[model samples]
Target chain A: MTINEIQDQIIEEFAQFGDWMERYEYLIDLGRSLGPFDERHKTPEYLIEGCQSKVWLYPSFEEGIITFTADSDALITRGIVALLVRVFSGRTPAEIVDARIYFIEKIGLRENLSPTRSNGLLAMMKQMRLYALAYKTKQEHS
Target chain B: MKLAKSIEEIRSDFPILSTKAYGKPLVYLDNGATTQKPLQVIKLLEELYRTTNANVHRGVHYLSDMVSERYEAARETVRAFINAGAREEIIFTAGTTASINAVAFSFGERYVREGDEIVISGMEHHANIVPWQMLCERKKAKLKVIPFSDAGVLDLEAYRSLLSERTRIVAVTHVSNVLGTINPVKEIVAEAHRHGIPVLIDGAQGIQHGMVDVTDFDCDFYVFSGHKVYGPNGIGVLYGKAEVLNELPPYQGGGDMVANVTFEKTTYNVLPFKFEAGTTNFTGAIGLAAALDYISLLGREAVTEREQALLARATTGLSAIEGLRIYGTAPQKVSLISFLPGAIHQYDAGMILDKMGIAVRTGTHCAQPLMGRYGITGNIRASIAFYNTEDEVDALVKGVRKVTEMFA
Candidate 1:
């Protein structure tokens, strides 16, 4: 499926929520469902600094698709990154680079993200695509 | 309770309270960060642009005189607001950061020397900490911190021992932004004075919570931000005693701050103007006066009663929750309550609260050292104001409970 289609599906799923409480409960559930990040890879190199909470994102290129791994100690931030990961993971480098990730705002959740964490979300997306761009360059050369 | 009754009516003067966030009523508890401007201040901003718009101090034009009159009048309002000794003592700057930076630069140059020590408390916003750090580095001086108790009160004994002939100036916050602990600035000032060292009180969070009588408080300098006090963002007050201000060299040299400018030799302008420098935010200054007037009408005692009552409500409600630890347990606090719920990251709770239309501050509250001292990275701070109601406090307590529940 296209990135836009996946994002659209997520937005539609979010729109079903009647209120913020239920929506956050859903996000928290999604966060808990994320398998524990391998501790070895949770190094300073993968960490995104300046977030209101600590976030670690690890990425690798496999079969020309970007495989992104991420975690945050804070559940809400973990949930927020989960939203990003769902949108961008398993995509080809070129596809990841071009995806707008507008589903956050489209679902009205972007407005609800606290100012500092919102920055962290943007940083998380930016890093994912940067990884994608690097993989795209590697594929182009090799 | 009487104050709360009147405050419900007072809340209407602020237009944002009537607005909604998502589907819920906006529960604004971030007044420590910035205040919602009253309609009086907002209208004054509009009126200034509509009618009283001109460059101040330079032009002999009628509009200039009128603009200058209002700008100076605003300075007088600030002077009265903080009970500053003289009109000349109140220097306008961009905000509390600017106000502190001016003193740090000018005062540091004049007094701070190599091997000299500048003492600040553990609980200071970066605004108070960074500028002094800069000055210390530039002057090859040492920076010292006065420790605070676990309950968030400054250790007065530690402070007394820290003072010495090497101590040039003592800078401390009158209130902790994170803990909401109101320090004994009067006592701090007295100690600094005893050592013949000058004290600068960072009143950025101080003035809004209660009456500040600079004459009685007798600090060498007092500083506060305008936005935190329901005024415009671009304006702040730096209240220095006339003699102390005269001792420090002018902070920035520019058009208005100079009496005469010759390439070879230039003389600076007088007291307040000497610090003002370039084109000031005259509109912001007018709005600040209007905000002060709004506060004055409500009366400081009433505001205090309402804010304290709300804090008590919030503290009680949140304490009922299991595994919640509040920071800054000083006997005298105002306007703010910050806590860390068990096993929940402050960001987790804060984001959930935001989603529910309950605005609270998360993270370090700009007091990183204090956070480090407490062995935590951040906290959820829900600071109330006179405009806030007990119902909103309940919303916060309920929201926090839900946050813990979802995370658990």
Candidate 2:
């Protein structure tokens, strides 16, 4: 699905939930569905910086599209990473590069997340985009 | 000795104190984390932003001059608050963390060498511990920690043994945030000086509880946050000894801190300005000064007595509760309590209390090392301030009792 379609579906699913707790549970379940990541992908180099929770994201390119699999020690943060991955993963490098996903405001994360968590989320997004940019550059070169 | 008015009258000054959560009035007991600002502090900030707002020290406009005057006056107020030698010794920074980082970056970089020792106590806030660790890592200096007893009091003998000729600096907290043990800073300073090592006291938790005269303590440096002392957030004071401040390099390079700057060598400004490098929190500093004025008018002795009474009430009340274990039962304590209940997560208790409109802090409180020392992941910290009352303590106890009963 397109990023906007996925976001709309997630929002619709969230809207069906009565309260924050149910929405949170849905988010966590979504994260669980992303399945497990490998041990090699769990190193400090791939670890998202400045988060109270430990989160790791690893990206790979397939036919000029970037796909990412991420994991986190914290359930909520894992869910957050999952949301980010859903929005950006499997998208072409150009699409990912053009996307200015307001993930924080959209997910209603800022009010719940601490300043550290918010900064960490920003850093994670930046890293993902950087990865996408590199992939795009490499694709052009090839 | 009763003040002219009851606590109800004083409570009116704080809007948050009267706020209701889940059908109950908010009984705020998390002053150690940060105190609720008074209406006066709030109004002062609003007024500064609404009426007279401008950048300080650079512009030649009228509003700028007015802002500069208020900002400098705040410095003078802080100087008098701590009884520093002069206004030039007080450097305005973001908060205690920034203030300490300034010291660590400047002095720690210059003086500390490989194999030199930097000593700190077990109960320091992360702000005090991490900067020194970073400094030690960079300079290849060894960081020595002064061990504490199981009771959470500093083992002075252990502290003494840790100090040596190689000890370049001794950084300690004036009061323990978790334990509430007020350290004998004067004694620590004297001991460190005997070894010819300068000391920096993290007074972030101290300034509100009691008086701190930098001259009386004779320490090399002192730091505290305005927010913790009923002032506005994002403003902190760094008081350095004149001679020591003169020697250290500037922390940040920017507009006000420099006298003249070219691409080549930069000539820095005077003492306080040299450290303060960016556009400061002018409103916050002014509001903090107003807070100081308010606090001074309230009288330190009155504030201290009221806090002591509140602590006594809380400890006695909590002692009566079953299965509740209180940490930091040191003989000398300020107005705070950290405790755990049998088979209850601290976060759960905190959430429960929040639901009942009783605000208390739960978690490591940015003092994870101290939590590790106590062999607990986290605890519920109920800290009191002078403005708090026995009634609030009653409410907190009642809330905890409800939680215990529900869990049981």
Candidate 3:
């Protein structure tokens, strides 16, 4: 979905809920439906630093496109990572590298994430972008 | 036990107890944030300003002398409250954060060297964590953290292993604000001192729950906020061993900390003044003294018993709820509980409770490392003070049940 469409859908879905609890449940369910991740891919290398929950993200480069699969021990944190993945995953290396997805500010996620989790999100984004940058460099060299 | 005074009489002392919030009686559970002051403390502040509103220890006038006497008397009160060896050892600051940072800046600057390690526990508040991290970064020192067990108690074995020849300092909280786990500080101090390493106990949460005798604990430094102990804001105490205070360099330079000033060289003042540095919070110090008087009248033992009873009731009530998980199951804890419902976010739960006129703290409570250790982003924290009642606990339980029913 386009960025605007995704934003509109998320807002509409959130508006249907009465309170934060319902919204939170809906968000977790949305995370669960973002396709299955390969269990074999979970490792120390994919770990996101500073998160309260244990979150793992693994990225793959296939034909210049970057695809990532992520999981978290906590349901809400998993939902947060899922949201992030939906925004950046399956895009070209250049697109992923250049995209300034303001997901945190747009969704008001920072207020929800603890200071540590917020730092973890930043760390995860940094790592993901680094992976894309490496792929772009390799493509240029080849 | 015969009652010296009833809760009704004691309740009258606090003006905020009668105030309403959101069209309901204010049920404040955010005592951990900052406590509401009693009439005694407020009266003390008012009297200080009304009768003797003068800068202390400098002027020759009667008001200045009275102000100085009151201010110094407050220092003595703090010294007795913490059972410090000497009144001169008590240096006032802008609260626990300032007190911890003073230790970090002075002791951490002078002693910590490259390749040396500073040990801290996983349950420390950010006030205790960030200062040490910054110190380590600046001095090229290594930071070692003592892990916590699943029960929220500090892993004593891991702590022993983390301590070695390179260890210069060990700073830990006397009580975990988030987990409500009262640490074995006396044991930790003894262990650290065996290797001649100095330990600073962050007593911001400790001073409220029970009595703290620095001599008994044998800690090099102990710090607490006045506001946490029913005192005024902008005031806290840092009690260091006389020898330790003498050894450390001055943290800040200003009016009171100076002995002599010259173009070429400047000499600093003696013991507490050398560290105090500024005009200081004169009124806050007086209010703090009044707060100490109030607590003493109630008696520490009485306050502790009352708080423990309230905690027991709260925990029992909260545990009865289905699918409710209470964090910090340590054998030793203060009157605080952090919990999460089976399928509800902590924030959502907190919002629901808030609507019912019961206030609670949600999120990490500034102990991010501890939260990470527990594998939860956050939890709802209900911290009880001595003034809290059984009826409040009942209300809290009912509120939590409502949230659970709504979510379920």
Which one is best on DockQ?
1
Tens-digit lDDT track of model 2 for B178-212: 99988999999999999889999999999998788
Location of the lowest summed lDDT over 10 successive residues in candidate 1 chain B: B1-10
lDDT of 1 by residue, B371-399 (tens): 99989988889989999888899999998
Every candidate's lDDT:
0.88, 0.84, 0.85
Residue pairs clashing, model 1: none
Q: Please rank every candidate by TM-score, starting with the best.
A: 1, 3, 2
Segments of candidate 2 deviating more than 4 angstroms: A1-142, B1-5
Error of 2 at A82 (Å): 21
iRMSD values, candidates in order: 1.3, 6.4, 4.9
B1-408 in candidate 3: lDDT tens per residue?
323567887888998987786587878888888888989999888888889899978899999999999999999999998899999899999899999999999998789899999999999999999999999998999999999987888999999999999999999999999888999999999999999999999999999988799999999999989999999999999999999999999989889899999989999999889998879999999899999889888888888888889999999999999999998889999999989988677755775677678989877888887888878788899999888889999999998998887656
DockQ, every prediction: 0.72, 0.06, 0.08
lDDT of 3 by residue, A80-125 (tens): 7777787778877787777766545655555545554343556777
**TM-score winner between candidates 1 and 3:** 1
TM-score-better candidate, 2 vs 3 = 3
lDDT at residue A91 of model 2 (Cα atoms): 93
